[model samples]
Target: MNKYLLTIFTLFIAMSGFAESPDSTEIAIKEIEQSLQYQTGTIKLKEGHGTLIVPKGFHFLDQEQSKYVLSDLWGNPEDNTIIGMLFPIHVGVLDDHSWGFTISYDPMGYVKDDDANTINYDDLLASNKKDILAENQERLNSGYGTIELIGWASTPYYDSNKKVLHWAKEIKFDGDSANTLNYNLRVLGREGIYLVNAVASMDELPEVNKNLDQLIASVQFDNGYKYEDYTDGDQIASWTVGGLVAGKILAKTGFFAAILKFWKIIAVGIAGGFSFLWKKIRGRNENDTIEAPTKPIQEENDEDSTKS
Candidate 1:
């Protein structure tokens, strides 16, 4: 009787192992492939300010679906400030590796570039580190992980010709094994700034920087909204380049905390997400289905059509 019971237990363990095999997981994933969808091409920004020319090897997620991914799927708090998202063309919403970056507009008034030439990034980084330390308790109290600024992955670079400011930071979050790469691009405009915040693992900095120039060039402000269009009566942003780099604007706009909390999820997800999407995208001619354009026109109320 004891031998019979032991044999039954061994059989149950064997069956359980088979049930959880990788092949079964793959079969389940394939079954839901038809329901999974992704969007690419041009994505119009809020208030008809401009359009992000979603590059050839990328896709865009509209505001609502983007919010869901950030808040529900990735476990970040809901952020209404996010206007849209840019994802690699190969990845879908369910992919676990990475989701790419978010696009947000801050109508904080025109920022002056007077201080761009003289600001010291080393000092700015030190100041930012102090600020992070000061805010860590607040983050802990809010149920989020504390972050340490490991230093700049890429120092601030501003293009006066294009009115674009770009920077990258290496950050370490509590309990996370990998460091987070926070790449920021701010396009100054007549009314405010267009922000592209891309978070990924530190290892992806090269890939992220390689695409940064093209992405920055793709964002075009409307005719009357360019940085040069700012008039005498237009409101001026209270902060300048130094303030922006020191995380003053980020703190004021409530993005500093959100970014810190979300990088942990991004670090874990990007590798798997990129790999899985690459496989799916390589399986088909995705470019043949989506129109790749230099500057695409905005479609009225087109956000709903792109929903998966």
Candidate 2:
């Protein structure tokens, strides 16, 4: 009877310990969230470009944390192309499954809008698929999975009045279980363009589109930086709306292929990174917090203004 009771007590203890593990994990997540100090409200963009009015249901991660999340957590190269990040308010900072948007600016000079209504999207899509197919070999050689452009999740639409070009692509990364939805928003300006790229699963495209209008409305250029402010002497970007949709601009930025690899990491992070971060955070003292770093958003660039 004593041996049986001891065995029963040991099993009970084991069960209790297992039950407590989840609670501990939850606590760790909460702590990490608190430490991150995620901000909300209007976040001013670098170089007097504009301000991002972070929507009511989202929070903004500043430049430093954004870079860390992309480079360290998401396994992308440490590039200054990232200006900041927009995260859903309901999700934890480390929650990878939830969709978030990365903001970047390309000072590739004024992008002319002459091709707004003239280009054929069907032809453009065909050309883009060929370009992607040709690039797949390089991606494979580099150890990144190849991608297939399934179709446009959301057709290209330009708001000429707002100078905002928005489109979405349905992409399948080789070996990925679910298709990826790449939503692109280009906010044209006098000096360059602001790129808002949202990476999410195809299933979440509807949810992403639902918030598109609000997100587009939230960004505005400062005075004298609007597209209408462009002068005849101002430099023009080598590409146009059609090229933008075709990923030509991204290719010049040298981020096109890296983006493919980056998204893979994002998928893995969402699927598994949270628990890993939870474990790391749990090892730290409960009282510890990751103080938000104060860093300027602008980084130095020496590239010619005419290049895109």
Q: What are the runs in model 2 whose C-alpha is more than 4 Å off? A: 1-28, 249-308
Which residue window of length 10 is worst by lDDT in model 1? Answer: 299-308
With candidate 1 superimposed using the best TM-score fit, by how many Å does residue 238's alpha carbon deviate from the native? 0.6
lDDT for 184 (candidate 2):
81
Which window of ten consecutive residues has the lowest lDDT sum in model 2? 299-308
The TM-scores, one per candidate, come to 0.72, 0.73
What residue runs in model 1 are displaced by over 4 Å at the alpha carbon?
A: 1-37, 92-96, 249-308
Candidate 1 per-residue C-alpha lDDT over 124-203 given as tens digits, one digit per residue, 9 for 90 to 100:
88887887687666655554556677888999998989999988778776666677777788888988888787746676
lDDT of 2 by residue, 192-212 (tens): 888887756777678788888
Candidates in order have lDDT scores of 0.60, 0.62
What pairs collide in candidate 1?
90-277, 97-269, 97-270, 97-272, 97-273, 98-269, 98-270
lDDT of 1 at 254: 31
Cand. 1 Cα-lDDT: 0.60
